[model samples]
Target: MYTEKVIDHFLNPRNVGIIPDADGIGQYGDPSCGDFLRVYIKVKDGRLVDVKFLIQGCPAAIATSSIMTELAIGKTIDEALKITDDDILEAIGVLPEEKTHCSNLGAGALHLAIEDYLENRKDN
Candidate 1:
């Protein structure tokens, strides 16, 4: 069963959309588990000004994406990179043991987005 926090997040997920001109973007999925997550970020003045996500999967994935966006907003790029699975699980209050992959989905997506932004910036 999903926890109250998970259910609440799923019912009223936050930052549940896309940023068309996002400074960074990341997408990740597990074909075996059928969970996919994508994160968008807008950075300003060396800080993460905003974040958005699109998730396709289970409750945990939804909750993770929602909470991850909330946590990443306003953080410096380096600071945001420090966000981990434990941080997400704590923010959501609880996660089903089997659904721990949701935390990874969140972290990996954010990390990939940041990496993409950095790489593209270097190319310019």
Candidate 2:
């Protein structure tokens, strides 16, 4: 069963889109598993000024990704990088045991995005 927060987020997912000029973009998930997610971020002054996501997944995946954006925005890159699957799971309340892996979707992609940003920064 899903929690109220989970259902709410799934039903009305937030930050569900793409950032064309994203400072960083990252993807996570295996095609064979059916859940794939892409996270885009805009960083300004070492902080995440904006965040968005696109996902091909179930309710849990959508909800997790939705809440992750809320958690990451306004956070410093260091702070955002610290976000974890457990953090998102906590913020969203609960996910079925079988769906728990979905918690990784957002945070994983987010970390990768930050890494991408750092990599791109180094090249410039």
Candidate 3:
């Protein structure tokens, strides 16, 4: 049975969309599970000014992506990078044991986007 918190998130997922001119973008998925996630971010002055997500997956995946974006926005890149899977799970209140991997996808995608942004900055 899904927890009340999970239900709330699933029903009203946050930050669900894409930033047209995102400074960074990252995508990841497992075809076997049909769980895919894409995260977009806009950074300014070394901070995550805005964040968005586009997810094509189950409720858990959608909720995780949404919550992750909400957590990342307004955070400095360093602070965002420090976000762990536990933080996401705790924010959402509850996730099925087996569905925990979905949270990883959200966190990994966000980290990847931040990494891409950092690397691109270095290159430029």
Candidate 4:
């Protein structure tokens, strides 16, 4: 079972693509479920000016990734890093207990993206 918000996001998943010149990129996967997510981000003046994702997963994964972009876009790097699994779940409504772990996919990827940016920033 899925929530209405979840269904809406899943059916029309947002930010589904890649940024060839992404300032940062991150990947996260749940091996147990064979779900994988790759996130791309563009930063401007220390803010996430753009965020996108490509995922191989189910409805929950799609919806959460969709909402994660909505939440992270325009946020400063620190704020984007704070976008957590719970933050995503609350935004998209409830998922089945078994699928709740899917909520982690987005925020995890997003955090990694930010981390990647920070790490690369040191080199620039």
Q: How many residue pairs clash in each candidate?
A: 0, 0, 0, 0
What TM-score fits each model?
0.94, 0.97, 0.92, 0.95
For model 3 the local lDDT of residue 49 reads 93
- Give the lDDT of residue 5 in candidate 3: 70
lDDT tens readout by residue for model 3, 1-124: 7787777778998888889988899888865679988889999999999898888888888888888888898999999999988899888877888898888888899999999899888999
Q: In order, what is each prediction's RMSD in angstroms? A: 1.3, 0.8, 1.4, 1.3
Q: Which stretches of candidate 1 lie over 4 Å from their true place?
A: 31-33
On lDDT, the leading prediction is 2
State which candidate has the highest TM-score: 2
**At residue 38, what lDDT does model 1 achieve?**
86
Candidate 1, residues 5-123, lDDT tens digits: the string is 88989889998889999999999896576898989999899888889998888888898889999999999989999999889988998777898878889989999999988888899
Model 2 spans with C-alpha error above 4 angstroms: none
- lDDT scores of the candidates, listed in order: 0.89, 0.94, 0.87, 0.93
Compared with the true structure, model 2 gives a TM-score of 0.97
What clash pairs does model 3 have? none
